[model samples]
Target: MLSYGFWNNKGGTGKTSLCFQSICFYAHQHPEERILVIDVCPQANLSELLLGGLANGGSDRLLARQGAVPRATIGGYFQQRLPSPYQPPAIEPLDYITTPCEYNDEIPENVDLICGDPLLELQANAISTLANNNIPGTDSWIAIIDWIKDLLQPLSGKYDVAFIDCNPSFSIYTQIALSTVDRMVLPVMADDSSRRAIQNAFSLVYGLKLPSDIYATYAFATRLRNANRTLPKVHMIVKNRLTQYMGKASAYAAVLRSIDRDIEKLMDSNPEIFTFEALNDGIVDVRDFQTTGVVAFAKGTPLYSLKTGKRDVMGQRVTVHEDYKANCVEHMNDLVGQL
Candidate 1:
């Protein structure tokens, strides 16, 4: 399967919301294909958004209280002993998947979720410790870092696309997700903080040491002006949550220009990893659909699915206008098309 990670070291850039929307849009557009989402964030916000009460507590409570049941979570998979690089773990990805039918009988079975666990934070630290102490030639670090990739090997042909949502930190969990993804999507808001976060992300990626031969190939690509090979290429640098008003857009022009200049500088220094053409081709600007976003979150549904009229959300009554919902759907469709 083609895997993509929606992440940024900076939080509150709408990473989870965008990731959720992409998965839902892709699943709806391709009903015949299977789509999977793995929530690696300790907060489990995406899991809670997608699965609702079942993610935090519901059926799991009854199952645990009634009898012994396996902990069906991404973190639970890492609790076992670390395997050698030559040996793959005997774990089934399907066992941990939570289907839509599990949450509600009326929902379709197109998308599945590998729920996240708060305990993953602890597991990440342990893995980091093991990786830090491993000898250079032992290949143990590869196995440790490639744990998620190996875990998903069995499902490579089963799903069309797998989207991973990671925490806004450089923990071992984030590294595992980064190492496994074919494409990386960086969601950045129109602000100064997001710009600094982008710079930090590039520095971290550049510091990572891969195998010598792979590193050599990457170095060689840097010399070739037309080369297009890079590990986990930045598929897009999404300019998210832009204001709808022209005045605000004019005010943000300087910040956007600054970000562009910074990206250009990075490209000049690291052509192999970041290219001018790639940056230009991957940049996308999306507007902030405030009303639609609030309604979607409150109703526990995608923005496109919001209906008109009054509805109860989290014990509060709210009204959704038809024009607003229609506008949100249009923007969402355009966003998905850009992806």
Candidate 2:
């Protein structure tokens, strides 16, 4: 199975949201029938999307909100003892559940999700304890990943893809994710600030000395509009509250093309450098996901329809894909092709 992670340090960039959509896309499309979503983000948005609620009520949410204690999450999976093959829990752990179908009956049958606890942020201190030779719990970090690998081993040939949604920071949890992931995708916006975030993400990947195959990215440029000629040329742009500041098409595309050319130059200047795409609006349509996992599930039904292709360059009314949904699918298809 292919293990992929959708990551970016900065928030509000739609990292978890896109990850959820990709899981849905593949679950419906891939037939070999092996898929698992590991939600490492404390935000638990992906987890909630899959399971429909946070584990242990909203306690996890409260803890993450306060940043008080890192939840004894996957850390417990490392140290927490499990029943042996010969024991009661048997081949699979107890937390696994098969509930009634929410979306397509066939689709949910092929899907299984491991949720993230809000207190997962607490794993940092747990890792520190283990590093200092204090194995307070059942296992260590190495044990955690091994346990995870073992848990999924049964579904080995059954799965064709695994999507892991990691937290924003470069903490111990992310380290485990990086070491285990077969590939990684970074989603960036079109603005200068998002560009800096991508740079920081690149730094994180390089710092780990992870193989080149494991690090890759796609840029989803959104909320862009054609404005005056004074602004910088960029590859893509997102429309936001400040409509007054967007540039015109001729000027904006010119700026974006400049950025794209600069990136090509950067890659040529450094062979290890990665490649990126400047996709227009492709985010998911929010209305498609009405009241949880229950979707309309109808053909030709727009997936969260939004305004597109209407207004003129100067503050014209335009509707793009809801939120990078299609762009993510396209980018992931390319990544899968690489594997």
On TM-score, the leading prediction is 1
Best by lDDT: 1
On a 0 to 1 TM-score scale, where does candidate 2 land against the true structure?
0.57
* lDDT at 184, model 2: 66
lDDT of 2 by residue, 223-320 (tens): 00111111111112221111223455655435445545545554455434342332322221121222111221211112232123332322333334
Residue 294, candidate 2: how far off, in angstroms? Answer: 14
**How high is the CA lDDT of each candidate model?**
0.69, 0.46
- Model 1 C-alpha lDDT per residue in residues 33-68, reported as the tens digit of each score: 888889888887677666533323434532331222
Alpha-carbon deviation at 182 in model 1, angstroms: 0.9
